[model samples]
Target: MKIYKYILIGFLIVTTIFVSNHGGNVSYALFYLAIILPIISVIYTLYVYQHFRIYQMIDHKTIVKGELVPYRFTVSNEYFITYRSIQLKFYDDKSQVVGGDTTVEYTLLPGESIEKKTNLRCNYRGEYEVGIKMVVITDFLRLISITFPIQSKYRVMVLPRVLNLSRLRILPLEKDAKRTLTCNNPEQIEMDNELRNYVYGDSLKRIHWKASAKKQTMQTRKMTQNPRQEMNLYIDLCKLDVTGMDQIIIEDKMIEAELAIVKYCQKMGVPINVFYQQDGPQKRRILNAMDFNKLYQESPKIKFNQKVSVHELLSKNVINMGKCLVLVHKLEDALCIQLQRLKQNRAELVLLYFTSELEEEEKVKIGTLRSIGIYVREILREEELVNIL
Candidate 1:
């Protein structure tokens, strides 16, 4: 295109010199044509920009992450004039058009429409715009080119991929199951000898009718304090320093790992308490499949832009005897110290650190945590979750 522009400029200069040196009708006509050629090219480009039609469609607006979706787009020329040197640019940051080039070039004749059919795959979990981002139109002369940004964009919501694990390797399923069953039995509720006045929100089953009658007031049985025995799962919601595709990959993998673990716990009849920070501290107790389903449905909306880090949230909570699973994108000294403390307090700690590559410093931190009896797993990719967990 640059070469064509330079040649045209050289021709215009020659035409100007010829008209100045000679007095002939042909010379003047050539000079005028040289000037009018560029004007006509610019006008043709503008005309094409206005008349060019683009239609993009996807089979669904909501799709699972990494799932292939059928997508097709059509470019048409409705006018009598032919459209030349048309190009397309797609949004390749978070989503991709499978088996298709990123930039597609085409030429359309009068009333001609070209349609491309392919599959679209979203690489992450979130709501983002996809498909044709911009259109580049060039004139036949290649001297004038116009890039028009597509006003209306195609958007889709991508849900996180949930993996079904045959069994949890990090956790002793049989032993944990037996302990969980023993702890959750209603018959194991030990009542204190002391009774207290029945509160308005107290359960009716806990009311001691005989004690209430003797005291001429409603009394409730005081239950013995049970230690924190349920599995605690923490998701790191703090935004990483990385941006663009790197951030997307880390956040998506963390969410997928959390969801997969939740599903596995539900399948194995293990109750889990998931903790994260959204607006503030958020916790979800998953004891059944329905609870896991609700969490799965809301996974796409979960953002990692929280001001609170997972370590801070853990510090605020009481960590006692139970399994603690922490999923974090980055490892910090403060977080490692907190994990060491949890381990010292007899809390079984499993750290799922998500990273593409481990640096020397990170490797040392991971080793230190593991040395202190914290089960640390560095997840390099989403596919490794099945074997690692």
Candidate 2:
């Protein structure tokens, strides 16, 4: 294109010199053509920009992370002029086009169209645009090019993938394992006459129907002692001060690891209490497959911009005894203090530290955490979850 522009400039200069030296009919005609040539090229570029058409479709608007979705896009020329030097650019930050080159160029004849069918894979859990992001159009004379950003964005929501684990290596699953060290096969508690409002994980058999009818609210018989030793899973929702892509990778891994543990517990018929900071301190109890399904559906929309930190939540709601699992991206001093406090309180702590890269300082902290009897697993990538957990 630069060479073409230079040639056009040289032609214009020669025409101007001829018309200046001898004002003949032929010189004037050449000069006029030279002046009008660039005008025609600009008009042609604009015409192609307006007459070009693009259509894109996907098999579904929502997909699991790392799963390929069928995608197709078509580029067509609607006008009578042949479309030349059209280029396509895709969004490669969060999602990618599979099994083909990403940068594609095409030339379409009048009323002709070109379609490409390929698979698209989203790399993280979130809502983002994918496929072609912009179109580049160049004139026939190759003197100029205009870039047009695609207005219609193909956005899709990617949910985290749940791994079905036959057994969890994080905690012992043996029949003779201590009840305090394992989440499976918790001892059932006996109910007392004291009644309270029914919680999500409360057993249906323990519901006090007579007290509920009188109080106009569902009630359940309270247990004298603590209930079953449920697994307390805490997910850190505090936003990280990092680049956009780095943040997505960290957050997606955290979510997927948490979900994989939840799925394992569900398979073992163990109740789990999930804790995170949303509007404030939020908790969700998963008791069965149906409860796990609800959490899976809402995973993609979960945000990481929480005002409260996981350390603050743990301080306010301390667990004296139970199996607790904490998922965090950063190892801060305050969070470490909280984890140590939980360990001192006889709570079985399993810390899943997620990061794209681990630092030397974090390695020392991991050693300290392990010294305090806290099971610490540093997850550098998503694939580590399968073996580490």
- Candidate closest to the true structure, highest TM-score: 2
Clashes of each: 0, 0
Clashing pairs in 2: none
Query: Could you tell me which 10 consecutive residues in candidate 1 have the lowest summed lDDT?
Result: 179-188
| Decoy 1 TM-score against native | 0.82
Per-prediction TM-score to the true structure, in the order listed: 0.82, 0.83
Deviation from native of the Cα of residue 188 in model 2, angstroms: 6.9
The C-alpha local distance difference test score for the whole of candidate 1 amounts to 0.85
